[model samples]
Target: MLNIADTLHGWCRAARPFALATVVGTRGSAPLPVGTSVAVDEDGTAVGSISGGCVEGAVYELCRQVLHDRGAPQRAWFGYSDDDAFAVGLTCGGELDVLVQRVDPGTQPHLAAALDETVQGGPAAVAQVVDGPDELLGRTLCVLGDTDSAHGTLDGGPADRVVAAQAGALLRAGRTARVEVGGDADTCPERLSVLVHVHASRPRMLIFGAVDFAAALSQAGSFLGYRVTVCDARPVFATEARFPYADEVVVDWPHRYLERTEVDARTAVCVLTHDAKFDIPLLRLALGLPVGYVGAMGSRRTHDERLRLLTEAGVTEERLARLRSPIGLDLGARTPEETAISITAEIVAHTNRGTGLPLSHLSGPIHRDRALVS
Candidate 1:
């Protein structure tokens, strides 16, 4: 799928066929999220991972079978089996369903073009049938950004249009989801049931400072799969050479830039400019937004003063409570790189609803089950 688009695009350009294995469903402690894919060339070259190293060997062989068989797409289930130790399964006591589909560049040119577009940093979503009729297996429908027109088809009927609309919604939210379709004439023409996987664009991370800490945080954000933007009013400080990892470097007032930028529940905003002039107006605007994480960099006294100023400036305590004043977790970080880790860790914990407690003190599933199998 989209996760391995770069590798597949290379094969597509060379007219080499490949078998794509995508993890479409999960249960228990699935290591990889759904939409994670592995693509194998005709000669057994593989790109990407499904269950880390747990079931990759088996999946590689399955890829070869799918390419040669080239029949309907095949779905393989992997999970722990106490019945037989020799059986190929996950050791993490998790279950995953992988859908293997063969793609020929000459036959599926539209799909190849879609991969090309995605690899070139275009905004879109591709809904592929992972659970459905055998005839519809491996079928895909791509919904380009803000476009009513779609690139491919599922049944070349009403079902295709329905799935395209669903994919477009999830695409705007930057989410990968399992979409169900098919019913009576009110929905689909037939009672054929189908499930599709919709992969979306990356979330945005806006760093409202061009300070040394902002430079390091941009790198960490990019590594965590966020499209990072470093912004500042000073053009000299917000140059691309300073924050090479950032997707964008904007020279604009923090508050003004934030007002003009688009944000969502997936967006993260970090304010590293501790100066009151920059902090007050910016934090006032940021705290009221629907962004996932909002953090401000400052000392204890500075945090108190900033909060008082925000409260006087008409920011409610409820909105102020949403801000992570003083930024970062208490990791005793002295350097910018270490501070960046602390800040990003807090962001992940906030997004996942995780307690900032040590793992040794908590006795339960390492990962929340709800976080998986989505």
Candidate 2:
């Protein structure tokens, strides 16, 4: 979840040369995903991580070599082997394919610009050729998230244009994907592997209550990479000083604010107001939207009453099914901070299509999405 692009942007502005190592591919239960990266300076100072803490030492050495060589990008693989899982192999019993390359503003100005855009909250993606001829190794194409065009050179030919188009498509879809280019008969015989690293803005969380629980949840949501907004009809409670973690604080009717705001499928709507007036109207509007998560906090009796009111107000049965009443997971939470944890946990599970079960009980990938990991 480290913002490597932000770090790289600062380094580029300072005219500091660095080596960038990225996890281009993984097998089994790797600790990090394909786009995870670490930037190392000449003094071996590192920013970001390719693994949680498992393979950082080895990757750091590889980065140092890249800085020393100042040549074509190098590809290396690390994993648990039958002979030495304790040595260079990953102890997590997973395999990682890493691409190590030198990055300097003088040579790769487009990369610096792309990282700058990402750090500035503008959507962007960096597509790098991880596997290709020696001349093509480390070649890059940066696709702007706001437009279809791209910057950077990948042979300055049709293949680069095609790669830029593909990267732009992935950026528009808000996804990070690995693609093979120049494999076709008409293009080139050698297949080129490319990894597109996408940087998109954080999702939004709209909390419609300024109570104690709201304050706690605001902090939790911010930690979970949510652009949180705390809204309430009462100006006394909905103050910026009260919810310091929230991105914005507004004193307005919950339903009215939501109706006027811009919400998409990635947005999460939480109704902490238990009052019938605020709860009914907001749920009616929220349940019908295409948001990712919608939850209302209340007791069982209050939930049933809200359902009845929503039904009386003509909320569809299909939309009512989307409502998650009682707000959070069944954690038996009693305190406001605990309740906030529960709520944000449920939001994460819902967004990732997770079962909300303990890791011991599940037998699947631990990291749902590389994008979500950030």
Candidate 3:
């Protein structure tokens, strides 16, 4: 989805007027989600996208019309069935409801500030209803950062609060949920149909031990859209000059780094520092936490020795089981780059509950990765 705030920022900088088109609801296999947005400037330039090249042309024409009429923000719907429904229509046979709002030049600062705060605070969710009765239309509420407090509101009193609370809960789940509020549930003080959009931030993959393998693994992690961090106790190896593409390079002890940075189920930890002194403490620390993937590189003999050492160091057999001793899949990867791919594949498989079999020999959706789901 296009970042509406960026488009607005450009409009303000260029002193241009634009119309923002946002998806408010969907009935079937909609290409875009509720919060998907697009902006069209007075000069007919477009930033972002609303659909999968299905209704953009029609939306553009609507944008032009709104620009000419200087009309108030209004709700619009698009589908494939109507003969007059625009030449471009959804191929998936789904229907979409959208909101088209004219950018008010005066409110650029307020909108820009909100956008900046939201982006800086990381993945978050914001909900607004642009269509409907005068009493409930064009109302917006946003949960800034990772906190629960919201800015802006709908006119529906307790109903607005109910919707805001729902949005916050969805944001915490890191997934968008379709909710019907203001119905039989007394929780919704008023009766209204609302759509909730939750944007979850990317997960962090912090790779400890800046070795040759770390560089390759970092590249693989980037392909997976993880915020990759490469670290090592040795400054000489951990320098950015070595792994320039890494999101971050920390020249500190592995355990020390984990102590300062937050590591949760969404986080992954890799111990490539094969040395006993380095691997032992780092693995112990990582195993103690609820990190999604904790891997250390070693051979069968190496793993056995490491296990003995770890057991001596007070790590339990259950914790040792958590450590994917050999690391990566059974792909028999040899080179650094290939090994990195195998390692990343193993991580994806572990998270996705995969049997790690070739899909050509299996059935069902091959791309059943939860990372994609989230």
Candidate 4:
């Protein structure tokens, strides 16, 4: 699986035979998401996890069986059980459908190419037939979504084209899901059902400021799984040594850098440079883009002035509403690190549609089902 790309790549290159067990479906409070997986080598060595630990031991044996007997593309089900400690299931009140398949250089000629593309940090996806005809059970397809390039075939069947295109589309949008094709879902037992796992690069977090706050924010953003980039026109302040956590420290005008760089719906922009000259020009462009989050750090008076200027510069009221001025929650943070936490918390809340209210003040499920990411 793409999750353990390095280990898989190493096994593939060394011509090591292995079996891959993937979590393809889940219900209730699953500890891990759908694409979580574990790879077991010929020696019974495992590389990853599906359940936190509850189901790993059972799945480990499944992988070993797949390798020894080659009677695979096996599907196994595990569920929560409090009545029996010896039961091979999750203890976390969740159920999972796991599929284990054998992988080697011979049967899967694409074993190396798929791992290479993913390990190199390109946008790639792997689609495997989880439910379908016997012959199509372990059929897998690998796609480099951005380039419209693919590495494997899901059998030389007509269903191959369908899953390939869908896999590429999912990879481009950075989504993972189970899809059905080739037959009506209500009736046909032979209908092709594929589970796609995408390995897209980390989303970008553009922090436009070179202050100490930016350094702290860069660290916070990186810990939150963002590829942080710190940008400022001031070369001395924007040095990589200053913002150690930023993936890139750019010495360019903030507005100019944003215009030339790539940004998408998953990108987050933080305007920490409160100066009017840099703030106005850069924010005018960022507000119009299809980015995920846009926030600015400033006092109440600065926010009022910035709003008036952006309005005069023709940023509509609707677009202006998208900006989070006087950035972060009302955490009353007094230090740079604390402010970074406040800001990152707001970003997470916004992204996940979470109420800013403390959990103790509300009552319901602690976590909601996430929407299919794009």
- Winner by lDDT: 4
Model 3 Cα lDDT, one tens digit per residue, 292-370: 8999898888889998988999998888889987888988799999999888998988876888788788865333313
Model 1 sits at a Cα RMSD from the real structure of 3.2
For 1-374, candidate 4 gives per-residue lDDT tens digits of: 67788999899888899999998888777778887899999987899988888888889988998999977589998997777633587777778899898887666767577788788887888888888888888788888747655578875756666777778877766778878777743333357778888888789999999999999999999999999999999987889889889999999999999999999888999999999999999999999999999999999999999999999999999999999989999898989999999999999999879999999998755555555422
Candidates in order have lDDT scores of 0.84, 0.85, 0.74, 0.86
Model 1, 284-369: lDDT tens per residue? Answer: 99998888899999999999999899999999989989999799998999999999999999999988788878999987666663
Using TM-score as the yardstick, the better of models 3 and 4 is 4
Question: How many collisions per candidate?
Answer: 0, 0, 0, 0
lDDT-better candidate, 2 vs 4: 4
Give lDDT tens digits, candidate 2, residues 239-356: 9999999999999999999999988778999999999999998999999887888999999999999999999999999999999888999898999999999999898888768898
Ranking the candidates on lDDT from highest down gives 4, 2, 1, 3
TM-score of each: 0.85, 0.84, 0.72, 0.89
Best by TM-score: 4
Listed per candidate, the RMSD to the true structure in angstroms reads 3.2, 3.7, 5.0, 3.0
Error of 2 at 300 (Å): 2.8
What candidate 1 gets wrong by more than 4 Å, as runs, is 14-16, 82-87, 189-202, 234-249, 368-374
Which residue pairs show collisions in model 4?
none
